[model samples]
Target: MFNKIVLENGLRIVTENIPYVKSVSIGIWIEIGSRFENQSNNGISHFIEHMLFKGTENRTAKQIAESIDSVGGQLNAFTSKEFTCFYAKVLDEHLPLAVDVLADMIFNSKFNEEDIIKEKNVVFEEINMYEDSPEDLVHDLICQTMFDGHPLAYPILGSSSILEKINKKNVLDYYKQYYTPNNTVISIAGNFDTDKTIELIYKYFSNWIPVKKEKDEQCPPMFYRRIMGKTKNTEQLHLCLGMKGVPQGTNEMYHLMVLNNIFGGSMSSRLFQKIREERGLAYSIYSYPSSYKDTGMFTIYVGLNPNYVSTVLQLITEEIDKIKNGGMTSDEIYKSKEQLKGNYILGLESTSSRMSSMGKSELLHGKIYRPKEILEMIDSVQREDVENIAKEVLDFNRLNISFVGDINNNQIESNFKKIIG
Candidate 1:
């Protein structure tokens, strides 16, 4: 069982105590990310995540690193489309030092001008690194094509041109506007005294006052159907086919999970078996569902010789058509349910995973389903539920496509229309 407490200023603290483990994982989750920014400040959320580690009022960057390192602990952070997280893992005895270091970074980071300029260059290099990977670049291309005009399409790592213009004032303003106490959640898991942990959290975070910022109304992104391509000089063509999917915090997500597992999510799935095992057409082929707050995308990816694009796509289309036309068996559904339960249970064995699961759930959905409840939900998904979600998610007319590598866009688009139509 997990415990939750809400401070007077609306800061939420959630914890799970595991008496057997000696280490504890703590996460500070903020409900702000690229989705909250506009064209001018597209990657500010991710940028701030980097800056918070550079230095703070009381500790130099080296000292911050040493604080955790001296204790044999780990510290890191990441930014996503909808949120950002800074986390640390240390032995239970070092929890106080971890909390103090993290709180200092959050509340007193000095986003100096010199650091801003230097980090911009670092982020630019990071973008270059991403561009070098055709497989990874193609996935972002799919989002740009599917979400076209929405902020959700904005890359977490903003483009160099926009990032170059961001100054300390811009960073500070954005940070002040979104990084509020009420907009955050702290989650901890592993061995600890629950009462002592709560008091420790309050000691570090209670006095932090909330900021008043006007709420920005976010309209859900509309899914667009278009073929987007990037001409990269790479050996194999990287491809992504996307369709509409369900949003977060819904029963429909479980249904889609069961459907995805049987379709292409696992090694024994149809896409892997037919494309890689039997025909040996591609080295990699898979599908996944990415859900956001209000909308989601189901993506299928394949990496193969450009010469084999037509054959691979045709095989993928055939699989989709088969599933749409009542090809899935009850046995597949039962097996997928068991697989999901096993994976979920195993993932909980890690304190970091549990902390993340609790933090994201409380920050986004304001509720966390216990393991038994989630397993029951997965078990209860009937064949009809999977079929219904499949029909909704696998609409051929609404599918959007993206590709990267040495291929002619016109030829690939023409082939897609001819085969998928």
Candidate 2:
């Protein structure tokens, strides 16, 4: 069971006690990310995330690290399309430290000028590192192409041009706009007293004055969401294709996940078997769904020899069509459900993953749908549910394709339209 508490000031705290675990993981989830920015402030959300760890009103950067380190705890954070998280794992004895430091970073960052100038260079180097990695490059190109004119197209690691000009003022302004208890969730799971944890969290978090922005001013929809294609310089041909899918929390999302597993998400999935092992096309191939607050994406990716790229793409399209038109066998449906259940149980074993699950659920849905409830929901899915989702999202006409790698005689780009069709 999961328990929820709302403070007088409107901060939602969700707690779960896993007695079998020796450690507790706590996550502070803020419902703001790249999708909240516009072209001028493209990567400000991510930049703000980096700046928070520099220091807060009560603790210096080194002190913050040492506090967690002294407890043998781990701390890290990430910025995503629809949310940002600062998370930590520590012995149950140190839950108060985890909550205090994570809350301080969220509500009390100083946004010091010296830190600002230094961190911009750090961010710039991070962008350069991303540029050097082919995997990151391909996904970046896909988002840019798919959401062409929207803020979602902005790279999480701001473009070098944007990062060079980012300043303390920009970081502070973004921070003030989005980081607040009203816009945040605190989730903790593992071996901790739920009542004591809530008391400590409320002690630190109750006075968070909500950051308010004028409702009259509206930013445009953050994602244009279309198909994007590109050619890049690399050894193997890289292919990415997808279309918009359901928003988070939709019942269809459960079906989509199960379908994706049977189609491309699992090691025994069609794409992995056909493209990787049976045909020797490439080393990696899979499909996944990315969820945002109000919208999401269904994507397929493969890396293959240039000579085999066309066949691989054709096979991918054919398999999708097969799923939509012919649907799955009874055994496929049963196995996919089993895989889904296994994954859910296995994922909950980690403190980080469990806390993240509760944090995001509370951020989006106002409560943590208990893990047992979620498993029951997954078990309730049927063949028709999976087929309906496949037909709903597999429309090639409404999709985007991103191709990376330098093919000496590249016909993949030239033949993409015909091949996908």
The local distance difference test score of each candidate is 0.93, 0.81
Give per-residue CA lDDT, model 1, range 142-183, as digits (tens).
999899899888999988888888889999989988888999
lDDT of 1 at 135: 88
* Residue-level lDDT for 393 in candidate 1: 99
- TM-score to true structure, per model: 0.99, 0.93
Instruction: Count backbone clashes in candidate 1.
Output: 0
TM-score of 1: 0.99
Model 1 whole-model lDDT (C-alpha atoms): 0.93
Pairs that collide, model 2: 227-400, 228-401, 234-406
Candidate 2 structure quality by residue, lDDT tens digits, 162-220: 77777777777777778877888888889988878888998889988876665233343
Mind sharing the TM-score for model 2?
Answer: 0.93
Candidate maximizing lDDT:
1
Clash totals in order: 0, 3
Candidate 1: segments with Cα more than 4 A from true spot: none
Off by over 4 Å in 2: 214-231, 407-410
